[model samples]
Target: MAEVDVGKPLPAITSEAKPFWEAAAQNKLVMQRCRDCQAYVWTPRPACYECGSERLEWQELSGKGQVYSFTVIRQVVGRAASMAFEKEIPYVIAWIDLDEGPRMISNVVGCPVEDVKLGMTVSVVFEQQSPEVWLPKFKPLVS
Candidate 1:
């Protein structure tokens, strides 16, 4: 992992999401799973999105998925906040359909932005944003 851009916005670690961030720092991808319904929960919710069960536990994931949708960011949009990514204009942001059934939005890296396609297979790669934060970005999965 490389040093994060100082201008890049970092995630605020909430108690519910602390575990996920901690795991990412270890270069692992994990999500919460409901013990009662066997459903995977994302975004660090308080209860299962599927069965409304509060019996959730953190579990490691395969870190593999397919691009569900994507867009090439060619311009900086917002105010000061968007300027941080100005150097990374023309990056690809995509929704990935994980093998474990969760759809997560993350940046697709390790390849040309033009090469990204819908349903293209990808796997997780951590990018260190800070000592306690590592973002899970996706890259093209090599066979």
Candidate 2:
């Protein structure tokens, strides 16, 4: 039921979060939408943020978004990130505002941090961390 870092002390997977992780394994992004207010929400709860209604369901998104904000990690500073962290140290991590109206934290890969900017168009790509798990990553949308 766990993906990424099977035996390691990290990559802890939980029951409440299993579905989201499972869906991501299929290269899909899932976010709960409030059935009452039709508002997109994150953290996967059974209620609406706008109307406080308990009617919610998970929906798949296009996985396209704009970078709201980001940081270029120039150093690993720890070993838990990855064994190749040194090589991939300088990476961009960002909060992306999905077209569905929810913002989620994720990493922006396949590009240099210097080129990353706020409001940059991006689309999703999946990296298989395990046979049953794929992490959703993003790349700049080329015009």
Candidate 3:
């Protein structure tokens, strides 16, 4: 199944990825945690990214992290080019190292693109791109 149109291509819902997307639709950030190694699995693989264990369970995240890396998207290309995104030029895309040890590739919103920096503290904000998809974004965590 597919989510509502967010003016961009939605992710293809696979059997393995269904749980992750389902939690997002409910405005929650979740990842697969390996039961054997106790490691969080990203990318929704069938096995743990750490110990290659198949015993995995869905776990919610605290939504706190630091900007491990970032880039200012001055332009969009390929499937990313859309009218909705055109108005969001010069956005900040970043790799956020979550407090739970997973790094998420997401956009840094609610701040100027130029203000985004490496090591910046951030917290999650769910953007409901469509009714069935709440895209996880981050913003600078205010002290």
Candidate 4:
């Protein structure tokens, strides 16, 4: 995978989200799961959204999912922030429904933007953004 440009925006590594980013750096996908409710929690939240449980554990995921929804970005609107992605104007951003039961947003790559479709199967691919950060993008699954 190609490294992200230096000017591209990177995620802020907070204490709660450190593990998720760290796992990505090692080419693994992980999410927080509520020990009480057994529900997967996203965005590194301190409590489970389902049962409001404080017992969350970091668990590795299968990294396989299907596109739940998507949109093609054909334009760059902003000056500084958006310009960073000008070269990749036509890209697919989608909400992927993980096989383990969580919906997360990521870019769907490795194919033409027009080829992306709803319910398309996908798997994780990491792109190193910095020494400590690897952004997990997804690509269409190869059958």
Candidate 5:
């Protein structure tokens, strides 16, 4: 696979999400957990999705999941946002359901697009785009 170039858009590091990204840079997957209801809040929100509590803590998770859904992007949409993937055309983007019960959208790497199947088990692999940014991608788990 060709290397994706620099200048691709990256997520803004806010105070609420800094820890999550920092952990990724260190090759660890972390998520926000609600202290009140024991719920794993996704997307790193300021308040818990289940209990509406401001008490949330960062917890590392086993980056393993199954593909809940997926699509093969055969073409780039010809927009600035999609330009980042111009060189990576015909890639598999998937919604993965982690073992911890939260879903994350990521690219399915290290395999052919046609091989990606629903409910296929996957494991996380970090791709460091820059010095501080590490994007979490997944690949099919070896049996």
Candidate 6:
């Protein structure tokens, strides 16, 4: 990917998050699953949130979901984000409910915040900062 901004604060890409970011680069989503209970979870934990088992693996997920709850940010907290998105004031952020049951936090794009509503269908779109780095963002699913 090309660097859209010469110097911007990027989210720390940790070892545990590599797989997810790489998958996102390929337009895929993945979450952790517990080997013991077959329960799926997020945040790339060392153990299952359901069964408390350290046995886990990364599993592919369908990148389809709907907005559960959301907030429109008129004021961004960070200097870098504020600068990068100064023209894009009032963006919608939300907890999207994936079809497989995981709720992921992401920003809703391709539409105005006033148009963004609860239970609106959304799909993932990746923001590539660098060739090796990618972040998951989303857009409304339009008919």
TM-score of each: 0.93, 0.81, 0.89, 0.93, 0.92, 0.87
Q: How many clashing residue pairs are found in candidate 4?
A: 0
Evaluation by lDDT, superior candidate among 4 and 5: 4
RMSD (CA, Å), each prediction:
2.1, 3.3, 2.6, 2.3, 3.1, 2.1
lDDT of each: 0.92, 0.80, 0.88, 0.91, 0.90, 0.82
Arranged by TM-score, best first: 1, 4, 5, 3, 6, 2
State how far residue 58 of model 6 sits from its true place (Å).
Answer: 1.4
Top-lDDT structure, candidate number: 1
Ranking by lDDT: 1, 4, 5, 3, 6, 2
On residues 5-54, what C-alpha lDDT tens digit does candidate 5 reach at each position? Answer: 56578888888899999999998999999989999988888999887999
| Residues 61-113 of candidate 3: C-alpha lDDT, one tens digit per residue | 98899999998989888756756677789898899999999998999999998
Clash counts for all predictions: 0, 0, 0, 0, 0, 0
Give the per-residue lDDT of model 4 (tens digit) for 1-143. Answer: 54546677778999999999989999999999999989999989889999999999999999999999999988777674355687877888899999999999999999999899999999999988788888999999999
What residue runs in model 2 are displaced by over 4 Å at the alpha carbon?
1-11, 78-84
Report the alpha-carbon TM-score of model 4 versus the true structure.
0.93
For residues 28-143, write the lDDT of model 2, one tens digit per residue.
99877888889887786656778998887888999999999999888765665566556666888899998877898889987888899999999989887666567788899998
Candidate 6 lDDT over residue span 1-143, tens digit each: 34466255676778877788888879888888888999887888678889799998999887889999999888766674646665666888799999988898989988878999899998888877777766788898876
lDDT of 5: 0.90
Query: Any idea what lDDT model 2 has?
Result: 0.80
Task: Give per-residue lDDT, candidate 1, residue 15.
Answer: 93
In candidate 5, list every pair of residues with a backbone clash.
none
The CA lDDT at 90 in model 3 is 86
